[model samples]
Target: MLAPPLAAGELERPLVGQSEAVILSLCTRGNRLPHLMCCISIDEIDSLAPRRDEDSSEGKVAKISVLLSVLEGIKDVPNLMFFSATNRLHMMDEAFLRRMSGKFFVGRPSSEARKRILDKARNALNPKILKKLVVATTNFSGAALR
Candidate 1:
């Protein structure tokens, strides 16, 4: 929906079916997309841009093309950034990966990392118990520990 434009009276109604035009305008035209952070999560990498063999819908392919173009276009624009987090890296399509300028892997914490994590939370536990807990939490995330 065109919530932003509709509120500002740019358009009388939402541009329901003009996705490509809208995306292109947002990327290439004026300061329609503000200079800010855009963090997103696509849980199923395969679903968005599945392997060509696994995808048959023309709409999906078209969507992939449009999305890639928009992302690739505005990547160098100052003060604009997109942060996407996905756990299913292996399932991501090659085109999606190719569009990414940098890729970082955040795996489970190592022993030193775990120790540092525990050091901040050692007030409630004995030293021996903290050591045991750190070892036992070998694969837990920072959020899980918190």
Candidate 2:
């Protein structure tokens, strides 16, 4: 069987306690479907792998070491892929950053998108208030709007 997609915030606990196993599972294939591909998406990557110099706790350091080892072991697995995102790229480990194949920036939501976001609460907010909120929330992220 192919690995299931891991959504944002889903891997936090496992990444602290069982990171190696979690990563290894991404590259495994069920005997009945050996050709199936796997994908793993990790959000807030900086939380899981902060810079070694900034956080030197024994557990944190050990977890990162194990995570890097598992990733290295799976580097040649053609059927496996990873996508990770972080708002604090500067706070992330340099070694972990090196392992990423590419990076992209996603800016704050546009005015139209922000309007739609406020529209979700149309029942709670009067039309006048919603319009004001949309204009007031310029450059806000979707999460911040929520």
Candidate 3:
């Protein structure tokens, strides 16, 4: 179910996306399963443990401590599936990375992939002028395209 946007004075609610829905459904179906699964994306991890620069002073250790506490609260769970991604994999704390079990780097697309993506974007645009617009937006990310 889609939630209504927040009003002027209301506190913002965390938006639940399709992944959250799928996880909920799985939990409902396997009520007896004694397993805890966590899937934290790289973007989320970065937000939680941002670099200590001029803009932010919080350390990565503090962030990892909080995450560990949350995981510890979960009841007996034999099977754990934790997933995380990051472009800056080296920046993450060694302890936190170990908990992930596996790490994968998702590099920017190659020339061929970029060309294919551009073509697909051009096709999706209405009117012939969209092709030119897509061409103008060279080297933009998928999110930027939207």
Candidate 4:
């Protein structure tokens, strides 16, 4: 259900041609790399493969085609796995969603969880400030707290 996060620059916009190669390499690197296995986590996946519609451009269509082909090619790979996260799942391509093995939704942290996150900075913040921060960060994500 999880894979290693990728470097920031790898997932930049205009994912048209570049993503296909990145996906292929990550899935096929098992043979060349010492681990004989590889995994990737593509954040904001919707930007990479949005649903095709009447307004879709040629480059967009081509990108989706290549992405689907790459994914299909790796379906039988035993040592490769990929996971992705997106806040806007509805904007993603249906074909792309169909390829996912499972889906999970993670909500914002609870009060205690928020306090725990603030505890990490306890050395820098006094007890009064930490308490205020927990309340201020209500409904915040773990990443936001960090």
Best by TM-score: 4
- Per-residue CA lDDT of model 1 for 1-146, tens digit only, reads 22121111221124433544544454443244555543333334455555555546665565556657667754334333434556667767678788777888899888778877888866677888888988899899886776
The number of clashing residue pairs in each candidate reads: 0, 0, 0, 0
lDDT digits (tens) for residues 38-97 of candidate 3 = 332234454444344455433334444444433333431334343444556556655555
TM-score for each candidate, following the candidate numbering:
0.59, 0.71, 0.46, 0.73
Q: State model 3's lDDT.
A: 0.44
Q: Which regions of candidate 4 are displaced past 4 Å?
A: 1-4, 7-19, 31-35, 73-76, 122-124
Q: Considering lDDT, where higher is better, how would the candidates rank from best to worst?
A: 4, 2, 1, 3
For residues 33-103, write the lDDT of model 2, one tens digit per residue: 44865566677777778899754976567656655755554334555566788889998988977877788
Candidate 1 CA-lDDT value: 0.58
Of 2 and 3, the candidate ahead on lDDT is 2
Find the 10 residues in a row with the least total lDDT in model 4.
Answer: 7-16
Root-mean-square deviation (CA) per prediction:
7.7, 3.9, 8.8, 4.0
Ranked by TM-score, the better of candidates 3 and 4 is: 4
Displacement of residue 141 (Cα, Å) in model 2 is: 1.7
| Residue 19, model 1: Cα distance from true site in angstroms | 7.9
Top-down TM-score ranking: 4, 2, 1, 3
Local distance difference test, each candidate:
0.58, 0.69, 0.44, 0.73
Error of 1 at 117 (Å): 3.5
